[model samples]
Target: MTVEEVVSMVSLIEELEAREAAARVRVEELESQIAELMARLEAERETWSRLRVTRETVAEVVAEMSVPDTAGEPGPEEPAEPAPVRVVGAVMVPHWREGLLVDALPDVYRDIVEVVADASTPMQAKQIVPRIGLPAVTAKIEGTPGKLKRLVERGWLTEDQPGLFALAHRATVESGEGAER
Candidate 1:
């Protein structure tokens, strides 16, 4: 055809190419954003899955610890051992009595209770959990200082030192729950 018509067609083609380049760049940007969002979703999903598993395991451990071998019940694939006896308020009480005293407790507290009772000496909260078989954490209970501190609140136990606890005389009373006033 004529050069002028050919030039006009070429200009239109160039403009179309520019638009296609802009569309390609936009597509690339959207793809990058989608990739980042997907990565974040995966990380969040992994965190939630880990937390769910942790909650289930902790619930099982606490339930198993709640009853222990206080009765004739076999526990946790481990043979039940007779609770150690200690003189509290001039009466003998199971050293693991604290384990039986509370209905619910944090895992570290449950671990600390059994651990402290079996320990050679009454230990502070900081010392008891680590020395006995618990994850040592300086982090205090929500409103309390440590395991012994919470046990003292339960009234079945008493704190002898800052973070140490001893079973109360009430631990041996007829109620057997240390609810003694």
Candidate 2:
């Protein structure tokens, strides 16, 4: 090759190498960012897991409290009335009873109860999602079934069929008849 041609090729190779180095730097930066994001995601997942366990544990404790103690009556020293439902960090689902009103539930659970009570026929989780002012997106829709199942477990709602949900036995608060209960 001619000397001039060789010089030009050398300059082009230098530019290409510079570009490749910049690309490698950019890749490293992205990898670092990805690693940070992955760590944050894992921490978030752990928090979510802990919160779920807390919720389930609270539900179990509430259920146990609701069951009438068959062993014996409270001694004269102990109060005769059952302990009132307690609200901890997040309001827990209480076992429904004659005097337990829908208003006592957490906002979302209350909304779900009201929606099911309002529906003429039993409704599915997807159908209930939008009625409570939530977007009917797949994530919300998919998440709702778990709430519905929890409500069923807590006696706030019933699953007449596989997916269809209805109020367990209570009327809506708006009705005023069973509002206090």
lDDT of each: 0.54, 0.79
For model 2, residues 14-100, the per-residue Cα lDDT tens digits are 999999999999999999999999999889867876787678667667667665673587888777666655545545676676666
For all predicted structures, in order, the TM-scores are 0.36, 0.57
What is residue 153's positional error in candidate 1, in angstroms? 35
List of clashing residue pairs for candidate 2: 100-181, 101-181
Candidate 2 segments whose C-alpha is farther than 4 A from its true place: 1-74, 85-90, 171-181
Residue 12 lDDT (model 1): 100
Task: Write one digit per residue (lDDT tens) for candidate 1, span 115-157.
Answer: 5555566666665645655456533321124335545654546
**Relative to the unseen true structure, what is the C-alpha lDDT of residue 122 in candidate 2, on a scale of 0 to 100?**
96
**Residue 103 deviation, candidate 2, in Å?**
1.5
Best-performing candidate as measured by lDDT: 2
Candidate 1: worst-modelled 10 consecutive residues by lDDT: 85-94
Clashing pairs in 1: none
Candidate 2, overall lDDT?
A: 0.79
